[model samples]
Target chain A: MDGIDKTDRKAINFSEKLERISDLWQPRVIAEMNDYQFKLVRIEGDFVWHDHPETDETFIVLEGVLRIDFRDGAVQIGPGEMFVVPKGVEHKPFAENEVRLLLIEPRGVLNTGHAGGNRTAQNDRWV
Target chain B: MDGIDKTDRKAINFSEKLERISDLWQPRVIAEMNDYQFKLVRIEGDFVWHDHPETDETFIVLEGVLRIDFRDGAVQIGPGEMFVVPKGVEHKPFAENEVRLLLIEPRGVLNTGHAGGNRTAQNDRWV
Candidate 1:
């Protein structure tokens, strides 16, 4: 990414990723380089209880409301308000309606942090 | 930059930079980690000719029209249509009205690539 001089960093669209993945709750890699990954995830309702063991992931609400529930309290974010969940913190993210989110995290970030549950999707297929 | 776990990259507002720099035409760094830089620039009217020697900068029009004049042709982008100028291309950017743009480039991106002429500001001061 260091060579991305003003002339070299071309503007790229993230729409192509949206078309690739259909199922909800799974995140697909849209852009990646080295250890970083930019993923697009479509979510609805509440997700399984999980926690990342190694990396902290960022969630940017692209369209709808996102509620991140923590041990202490819950945070609600709209199209813009962003909250950073601490690493290894147990959390659950839910949305009332289908919401598009841009997730930034390191490579190898697992969708189900704590493994299988009723809400966990079967495939982590790249879309 | 790799360590920017989603937890670490807390949602930060770009409004702070918007307040610090009142003068037009100057780009200020609002966020930086390693080589990547997110800059905010407020613009008005037409600007002098300039070019980047190494990097290809990505410009996202946050507010108004941004017309880029190249030797071969011209391109006007509004809102989200992004175009990347190749390395070492001489061009002049102009705006018929006041505009705000988010510039993404590597560190050390100079505002005036071709030195003083008319639109060149006296300083490239960081806000």
Candidate 2:
């Protein structure tokens, strides 16, 4: 079928997703569709408190234990677990062990959580 | 802390994504944001050749080997690998072993590949 279309989404591998992030706290984009982007991040220990003001972000844990502390409730996401933090809701993420996670969010989302800091990354650094 | 915004995307689990699908050849919507949708599918043997006329689809292989036969060449993707089939391209997927995958594409994507089939499904199924 020369002109037949595959309605199925093309497959993307995770190892390549891992190749994009080299350090903790920094995330690099692996793929993008329309206005949304998929990112991969490696983390260990505590990260600064932050929030995206305009978009909700989704996290899928491929490895390790991850904890998210919110005002009313906190959630611990382990291997295979995912959570979405609503936009503008304050939260902090901490991982005692090294973790590999996939993030889906909009483009230009700040890494420092919100606004500015020396921790804020200007451009995505690929691994 | 009571008011810290978590910077990490809240984690969403895959087992839960699996619970959303019930049969083979059928794809179920597990989650969505904006115009894009995340789907889970269980597939086996040969599927009808088809394509998405508008949006490019993304596939992430969670288990088993999947073959996407393109016009000029074909690719076999296994666990942890992914492939993005460009839009308006003719292709068919097949698996000798049962395959589980994640589909990330736009809403209202036709399952029969490009158009109508006795197999075309409407409304996402939740298992």
Candidate with best TM-score: 2
Per-residue lDDT over B1-127 for candidate 1, one digit per residue giving the tens place of the 0 to 100 score: 1222444434444455566778889888665433555677899887777777776666656668888777655777675335565557777788999878766566676777655666665433455
Reference-based lDDT, residue A30, model 1: 57
The CAPRI-style docking tier of model 2 reads acceptable
What DockQ does candidate 1 have relative to the true complex?
0.14
Query: lDDT (0-100) at residue B13 of candidate 1?
Result: 43
RMSD per model, one decimal: 6.5, 4.7
Candidate 1 lDDT, A10-51, residue by residue in tens:
333445556676878888865553355557888999887787
User: How well does candidate 1 score on lDDT at residue A105?
Assistant: 61
Q: What DockQ does each prediction reach against the true complex?
A: 0.14, 0.33
TM-score (C-alpha) between model 1 and the true structure: 0.58
- Which candidate comes out best when scored by lDDT? 2
lDDT of 2 by residue, A12-87 (tens): 6677667655667778777765566777788898777787777777787778898977766678999866677767
